[model samples]
Target chain A: MFRDIAEWLANSPAREFSAGLLSSIPGLPPILQTVHLLSIVAIMASIVLIDLRILGLAVPSQQLDEMIVRLRAWTVWGVIGAIISGILFVLARPNRYLLNPVFQIKFILLIGVLILTVCFYRWSAKNPFSHEPGNNIGIAKGVAVVSLLMWIVVVMAGRWIAYSEYLFWPG
Target chain B: MLNEFFLWLEYLPLAQHIGATWWFPLMESLHVVSMTLMLGTILMVDLRILGFAANRYAISTMSSELVPWSAVSLTIASVTGVAMFITRASTHAVNPALQIKMLLMVLAAINIVTVHCYVFRGVVNWDAGKVAPFSARFSAGCSLGLWVGVFLAGRWIGHIV
Candidate 1:
């Protein structure tokens, strides 16, 4: 099923156009990659700050709710930019990404992290500690640690995509 | 000459090992991790100074809390970066993208010092919920642009070579 989907995407007109355009440009792929990386920096940094706050390790003077509000825009825009750039990258070479196990792992990690992040945000919004300044809830700290670890894995998986050929791949 | 030194460095056992083994990709991954941490923290602080984000927090407070993470990440990044460079020191040393990245880093350091010694000294006056003075904002803007340039140049090094 996965191979079929990848094959279909690879043969799609959109992919053909994207591949042609990306190939025609001398350095467009790297430029898109740069943007993708920049967006990752934004996302990772925002996540780090929020997680640190929950762990009582950073910005102790600021209220959690307020801090979340402050970082929301950065996180939202970063995700938007990353998604757009990531889709373009896949469109440029659908099979290269869609069929790669490492890419599949990265995609899974990204989805998991997004869901975790949303749930954590919603939970914090309702939690009392969020309104209280410098107060770190135990549950939130646990979640923060998990969140940090998951993000680290996501980033590692992202870097590994380039070297996926060395890893276990049946095809 | 510096080229000879780089060549010598590249021949070192540690550099040779990194060049020959799987260590290169591992170190490269670590480099990316640290880069995000360093850049991310710096971005927040810069955005704060520019009155674009986290306005309610005092500039000093945010800097004090966040800069340490940025500093630590910078240290890790520098270490991994040097490790990677030594593996192919002569080639990296001559890479124009790398040279530009290094120069940008120097400028960034200078900008940080200028902020600490000059713009930041007056931070107390407009530290919280206020637009910082033009000098401070200008420094912050420069910091943002320079760091972005550094990242882009660093990325181009692989392609350029």
Candidate 2:
């Protein structure tokens, strides 16, 4: 499967465009990384703030609904940052990543995460968090745990990618 | 300090496989994906807590509802990640950037654990339209800082020497 992808990418103009576009930009990669980092930081900031709210750390008197509204701007911007940098990374090495199975799984998992997030975000639109804060402890804890685990896996997997090799045994 | 052990370990066949070809790259792609999921969900949860987006729902809804997918994504990324490490244990073990990344991961874990263990331990029933507790808010701030640091460290791994 990987072989086919590698062969196709090697032959395609897409690879040329990716390399050419990147080379022409000159210093683009580093710039993108910085932007990506900033957005990630913003996004994470908003998230932890809310999680803390679930945990009962900050702004106890404020309304839960109001807090979520304030955090939306950060989330949207963070997603945008990821998208921009993600494309740059993929474009730079399309064939290598396209052929790799880990990359494939990552794409699948991304889709899953997006689907689930939308579901929750949409649901919360109807029901506001009560002053009790502790009201829905199970749900809040679950989300925080899932998020922490997901990111750890992602970081490790990325580091691991520097090490993948594929070989098909002789028939 | 542990770099020596990792250096020795990188000599193993699996490490050779990762460094020799395309496996590590593949794993990296997955890692980035998991990062996005984790990032996206956390943002959503945090926003909800701050009364930004999901005001209609309860504070706990963010965890119970949106985080499961992110967790599954993490599991997938982690398994493949460990495999990558085995492929080049010695080299990465010695790499300073890698060490920093590992340290950041540990800190992030601790931050998350604190959020769960200390704050939001029980039911928080909203009165009219009140936010979360003070301690929980502080925990949220700490969580934000830790996760952002984690994300930065993870990305910097590409430039690791």
Task: Give the best candidate by lDDT.
Answer: 1
Candidate 1 structure quality by residue, lDDT tens digits, B103-130: 9999999999999988888777888856
Count backbone clashes in candidate 1.
0
What are the DockQ scores of the candidates, in order?
Answer: 0.69, 0.14
- Pick out the ten consecutive residues of candidate 2 chain A with the lowest summed lDDT: A162-171
Q: Which residue pairs in model 1 clash with each other?
A: none
Distance from true location, Cα of A43 in model 2, Å: 12
Query: Which runs of model 1 end up more than 4 angstroms from their true locations?
Result: A130-136, A169-171
Give the lDDT of residue B111 in candidate 2.
Answer: 66
Candidate 1 chain A weakest ten by summed lDDT: A127-136
